[model samples]
Target: MASPAGTTARHGDICVGLMSGTSADAIDAAVVGITGAGATARLELLGFGTMPLPPEVRRELFLVFDQAERAVERLCSLNVVLGELFADAARTACRQAGVPLAQVFVIGSHGQTVWHQPERDSTVPISTPSTLQIGEPAVIAERTGVPVMANFRAADIAAGGQGAPLVPYFDWVTLRHPERSRAVQNIGGIANVTYLPAGGDIEDVRAFDTGPGNALIDGVVTLLTGGTATFDADGRLAAQGSIDEGLLARLLADPYLNRPPPKTTGRERYGLPLCRRLLEETGLPEGALADPAAPFSLRQRALDLVATVTAFTARSIAEVYRRWLPPIDEVIVSGGGSRNPALLSMLRAALDPVPVVTLEAYGIDSKAKEAMAFALPAHDGLLGLPTNVPGTTGARRQVILGTLTPPTGIVPRSQGKEGQV
Candidate 1:
């Protein structure tokens, strides 16, 4: 239910925003309360929680994306499975927050992206920019008995946009400052930034992906440890190795990095295949990355590769600020990449005088920021507002960003009802 215009509404509604990033590592669910509207909307994060994808589920999802054109059936089945996973995560988050599931009227979900082609290329046969998010909204609504909104990126693409960097809308709403310009940079699997001009309006926002963040770094680490390790674990692996400047320079020369804003990327570009190609190009032993890749014994070549990829992530990010962005007075870092000391150290060096801060300093849980982004917009989207930022996604016009799966009269699931929503 929307409020009368120009009248400030208080006592927000309870809603849940579920996010499954490109990493497919976990389904993060945030229990949030949203009040007011437009720039006046205030977000109160009641609670947050995450649930790791089962190892088996993660492997199948990888199969769906790694060789997707050939794995249509896997892609089809995984959608339902991922939806179930999302429902469970939402329940867990509500329980953690002491919020009743029945009271959660809206659930905003940014489902797992199986594939994203921001442009039509030799590989992508689509006539226009396209993207797909799984975790069926119908399934989520049926399972949770709450109206759900998912598939956030497609509407922007339909309007001739990149359908990326939707978070800028959220960043501008929550993190914008009255006087100082801000760059809210989120480094999840892929790094992206939203530039907010000082005392800026929504149209003043600019954003785009800054190439790979943990996507490349994590891929190489998984290969090196033969799946024994999922990530560098606090940048320890990178800390021991020295950055290879020559290799970093070549990586920086990538065309994707040089491309202008209104751009987006995913596993399609920076996944395992890219890591394997880098290994071959760097002359790091022919079979070092064969099936069951070599373990991380901290060998000289492995160490160098790790350090090189890490530097590439950080340097590419800094390069974006240099190339685009308005005069930024502060940088607020969020997402998984912020946890990497080595990555942050390199970023600090690249941005020099501009102060880089964490989302925590602003009362946000860095890890849960993306989830919150979806949560706030879900509430407003239900109130009949457009959430996608035209400048960031290159949309010709603004459009409502989600498809809803409405809750019915069936008893709510949390009340021990044994039926679907």
Candidate 2:
């Protein structure tokens, strides 16, 4: 296919996007074609694939990430493993699409973030805003022989941005309908939403984290089931359990729930320990807290946690819109959370009066949304164009968002006028 006019392409740009979100379950790889400009850019999804993390690897990663005394050497080793896994995924995606490795112009990898402390400052050696994502780009580049764009968050942080909810730029580009006020809500490890007002300017668009998503519910499931299950699959567990109103209220009282936009959060604030603490604080019994312990067994506790966590996500999103957004027309959901029927039901009930839809309804696959978002930013970086939305990320000014890791013997091409390379 010939590259579209005014679209940045040096012999046509075929880029692969890789993302392993806060959930730590799997890595999503997508091949995309970048064409056109801001608000008009067209992202063609050529192919997509997912590589599941080995069970043992997932457990080790959870332990190292959730605990405080993680060894440095182990963390270092996992970085390479993750890089190779990502490279393998990229290669698989290319093969599926029938695109040669060398033909791909770049790869945008949102590496596995082990920790994110957005509040970190000079005095605090490790605090918020100090985030670390694994999977070495050099390894990916060397393995795939394609230029890799990784560690995308650090640059946004360097420019004084929160380095999160970066997908809003993509959401705005792909989901903004001319006649409808739209909101793109992604349910990953943490839930976040980007609000695109009907007929609103780019400056008017808003995005922020909307509290816990599958992370807390997943953690609770693991604890209650003794690792038999990784998450409240299909929301089946949650469907049986009753929402402990008191516990639900307590979880919703978190300050993060009431925070304003331009904010972000991760597993650090809503992981396993926090879930255990919530349970302990609520004084729930070790066994089934409800009368029917058998049916609800592990399932009940998982559902209870899902109810509280998913409720928090829904209410937090509503709070953002109530406080900042003007009359939104519809809510479009994406990510793993969208698949949980129970959670979706809860969200629909909570967000009543306002319609709730999936990003797939608008022609974007829910699971592949985040990967596609990173692809847009990588495309922007390649063109030396600003990618971060200053209003949303809190950056001092607009700036291109990533460092380019070129393949051996290949030179970085310049973006000509009209954004063509």
Candidate 3:
């Protein structure tokens, strides 16, 4: 294993960034090159890849994650399974990139988040304002033979922060420009934005969850289609259904949409139960809603749900910009939500004259953006630099995020495998 270098060292390094967002779809692994230090941080994207969870695994994981009460043994068992899966994804990315596992310096895995309760107190079952991201770093390291840096959010929460919107640090590094104020909006299972002012200091950055990215849409689609569909692909269903204006208004009335910055939420608040409640309140359904049910024709209802969720996400982001930041020059979007034409159309409509661009326009793949974000923090961890932005995570003070898992042994390399070819 490689040992941590002294603070003054400045050597080129390669780090693998792994992330499984709120959607719980797959693990995104990105290889990034880090150079320079401190205020002069520089990043280069070497390669990237995504390994999806099997449909059954995804369903089981989501069930355990969304349910309030789950068997402790099952949760613990899944943690190890997830770790192995994460390692497999990382190794697969390495093979595709033609990079040797031994050559890579660090692996930064965001892990799979089962639950995030940042509002908890002493009396709560889980102590403190805690968050849980399984997939042990030790398993990743053992499988890949590389030092792994996991659990990036715990330190931030410990410092009185929300432990989310951590991507803003990377957004600041990758998108901050002297000429324009740019907003890097990621529409994942939940939508969030990182606002970088034109020529702004670190303190000027703003980030927060914009609510319900693909979460609600996916929920409705699954419920309506009887698990035959995971989502409303390309907004086809939504395009076929008319927006139920009354339900849309009711759905948008949730207090989360109106909350200020530095907030975070997940399936705990916006999952199937909430969707069912919304339907009931609108006098739409009774009894258990089954997929592929006749008479009610959930297809149209599902479409309406997708359209409304997309619209809500876009409108909330636009509202945030209008309220907190300066005139937005461009909105750079990324993640699975970006692929949804209906969502993008709604976003453009909501933002009006502001114009939206995908992260691809700036040379960052939308699916890999969050993984790359972890790379930035991992780089900071290795360098002893503060990774959290006080303005974004609500941390009392700036702190370097993540732990360093140094390489265990130096493996002698063959002639053809040594160094970057």
Candidate 4:
């Protein structure tokens, strides 16, 4: 079907956005129709879906992520491997929206973040702030026949920024309210918050990573279940256990939680290593919680660990807000962690008197919010507009984000392999 004569003029071009966050849970794709440009632009979600990463691909990706002696060949190969998967996700999302791939103007891929060093390391010689997101945009362009805007973080980092919490640009554009100062908090693999002062402009925004989101919780659950569970479903395990105040206090002492704005973190800090350490502290070993028939005392210790970590996540976020942000009218929560009642209940208690609500209340699919965020940047990049918020990223100046990869006619070598290639 052909678009109406004024459809493009009125509703703008059709674009696709893709992201695989630190969790490596799945690749999220959003097919969005955006109209206008810059802050005045509007977006309508045409379609959205998620594609799970193959187990082997995720395994190799994590190996490279956690290991100090990461092989160049493995990183090189997995980059292309993930590109094919991201392309597949784009096509799947477009198909779901009944929009032909050929009609899509661009694809914005955040890729899988293998490692992110947002600050200089004093322990390592010549260490500078750097980051790597590994799904190759060139491959996505080749397979989809659509231009791709990727590597969005490097430019911000180049300008002496943390190259993170990029979604503040999106929130400042779309969610800022005239009457209310809102904290748009996303509890993904890593929790970050964008503070939008009531009726303030982009320059007034403050954003940063509060600390671990579902990463630590999910890591603990995955370890406990011996691969049988990837997350604490609806935060059931946490709800059933008792919070160990001593352990929670220790977890809260993490310096990252107290660090001020324009900062970021990832699986590099909050992933499996932290989970393993917590398990060791609890005197529980791997798969200790896997057996349903385990001794009551043993299982309770494992459950208590889960509860403590859940409190750790909530307290970190609340503490950060208390330490830095101005009094806000409300906190609008989103991401995978928003669905966890145990976490939410704790957060609500910690920040009593402040209304806490999900993005769903405002008519947005929480799962698709971050994936959809990249589409706006992609659209703005094509228009030669800057999308990164300097205040949020700590960049010296506002600069356009992403590198563009124009479409080519060649087929991708790993089209049919999934991750096997």
Candidate 5:
């Protein structure tokens, strides 16, 4: 059931955070016990787990990502479909933590983003800056009987912000250092970095999308395997092959890489379409990619392509640091890309002398960082606090981020439940 307006969570209340990144690989859920609010907020991870998206659901999500081309009905049905899946994720996290559903104070869901156009189209007169992340909060609330906080981006966009890199709020609250400048780098389907100046306040934070992360590499792998494989698998293929310097150089030339901060990009720019173009440019025939028994020469070419894309992802991040970010004492890496050794090796080479480490070194799960971040914002929103950081997101002013959907208090006897880079 909905709490009275303005009523907030008591100290040590359990909260759940749900996230489905651009990879759309799985729903990451974290059940956390939160105390305090805003910068003083403290979060204790009770339990965390991931539930992979079903193949069919992932297929539909890609179609929708095609944007303005898919049928309206598909988008409509997917909204509720994702909501149910999200609810399941929340419940799973609680169960894993041995916490009852009734004990949860709220659920914060960063719903799957199908489209994000934070700026208006120059070619289309009617286009406006808008964003959409669709896993209906009402459905989540009804299913779990817990108040839900969602749509964390729209408010900032409406305030003339990029409405992205919102995780910096989390970075600021929990990861800031007193004596060391740090770049909290996350490499999901897209790579982004948050620079925290040593001992600086929230206004000193800086962040932006660097370029393609695992998306291009994952796209190529999926295409070459004819959907049998979706990623480079710890970058084994990339490690075996060689980088195509020409393709890598061409990818580095992307304007988005040079675009100023407060900018973001998604599948619309780096998705499967770019994967096909890169393959065509490399002269790899479609027939060879779909064949398991391809000639040794063609197989080598596939590996080379993966290596090149991984290099591109790493170089893009290093390039951004050189061009925009201040000198950093260290870089704390997180997200799916951190698992790729080849990608990490390339990143280390690109930024020599800068210590690069993972969140795990600091006693946090890299995969769970983003999901846990949202738990704080949900906690703040319930306390009627603003969570957006103007310096990072370019918002006109500080603004509270989510729209609250009060719980329906329904516990069903049975339920049926069911992204791209």
Candidate 6:
């Protein structure tokens, strides 16, 4: 099936986007068909697929993420391995969409973010702000036989921005409503928000990390379940208990919550170490919970801890809205945490009066929204356009983000690896 005329001289509108969020769980690949460019660009969601990381691959990836005594060999090997994983995801998504891989013009891989520092590191003498996302573009391009765009943050950092919350551009372009102010809140491992004023231009948008999302809550769940469970399924355990008011109050007082916009954080702040501390302080059982059937009193304590963390995440998000965001009618949510019932219920309670809705209301997959954020920006990149929201990232000026890795042209994309990852 050939594309109609004027759908670009070459590859038509098909493009693939790959995203692995702070959770390090699966690679989300979104196959989008973008026509025209910029705000007027029309988008079609052809297909979406999630490729779970192999357990061993995920473990090694975390070793580099959490441990200080990391090996360069591990980092080097994992980078290529992740690229292979990402390529597999793209292929799967394209096939699912009934689109040939070679017909897709480009792939936008946000890669796997191992470390991101929104603030400068004063310990280094030079004191330059920095961020790192691996899964090299060259590797993806080589393996998938497609042009790739990646390393989307470094350009913004070079321009003195925090290089975070770049998604505000996508929110403004794709989501801004005609008559009402809206907020797009993504509750990935790290929660972030984009506030779009009514009929907002690019400059009217404001965005920043609100606080911990599934990162802390999921970390605690993993601790309780030993290595068996990756997340609290549908917030079941949390629904069983009560929140510890005293602990919730203390966590709410975190200065990062009060910190202004142009901010971001990752495992460095709310990862395993914080979860371990919380578990130890709460006196929860450790080592394993394959069968969490415990003495009633002990089980109650564990449930309370889950409830407290869930409360903390909801409270922090609501606080950001109360303090920083201007009046808005709708709070549209996305990301993995949005699927957590307990989190959404608490969020709805806190943001009473303002309707809390999922991105599905707008007719898009909430889970694949971030993956699309990267894809559209890659389109803008090829068009030589700037998509970064200067106010959100504190960049001096709007600039194009990401580096392009053209295909090696050694093999046709359709002939690339099919079944194996």
User: Candidate 6, clashing residue pairs?
Assistant: none
Per-residue lDDT over 103-174 for candidate 4, one digit per residue giving the tens place of the 0 to 100 score: 676789999998899988999999999999999998898888888899999999999899998999989888
Q: How accurate is candidate 3 locally (lDDT)?
A: 0.77
Could you tell which candidate, 2 or 5, scores higher by TM-score?
5
- State the displacement of the C-alpha of residue 411, model 6, in Å, after optimal TM-score superposition: 17
Better of 1 and 2 by lDDT: 1
Runs in model 5 lying further than 4 Å from the true structure: 1-11, 67-70, 287-290, 408-421
Residue-pair clashes per prediction, in order, are 1, 10, 4, 0, 0, 0
Number of the candidate with higher TM-score, 4 or 5 = 4
Q: Rank the models by lDDT, top first.
A: 4, 5, 6, 1, 2, 3
Residues 256-350 of candidate 2: C-alpha lDDT, one tens digit per residue: 86677688898988898897886676555433333344563544554566567666666666666677667778999998989999888888887
TM-scores of the candidates are: 0.91, 0.90, 0.89, 0.95, 0.93, 0.93
Clashing pairs in 4: none
Taking every candidate in turn, the Cα RMSD to the unseen true structure, in Å, is 5.3, 3.6, 5.0, 5.5, 5.8, 4.8
Worst 10 residues of 6 by lDDT: 412-421
Model 1: residues with Cα > 4 Å off, grouped in runs: 1-11, 68-70, 123-126, 285-298, 409-421
lDDT pick, better of 1 and 4: 4
Deviation in angstroms for 110 in model 3? Answer: 0.4
Tens digit of per-residue lDDT, candidate 3, span 212-265: 888878776666566667777998877676677776776667788777778888
* Pairs that collide, model 1: 142-421
Q: Which 10 consecutive positions of candidate 4 have the poorest summed lDDT?
A: 412-421
Q: How big is the positional error of residue 129 in model 3, measured in Å on the Cα after superposition?
A: 1.0
Worst 10 residues of 5 by lDDT: 412-421
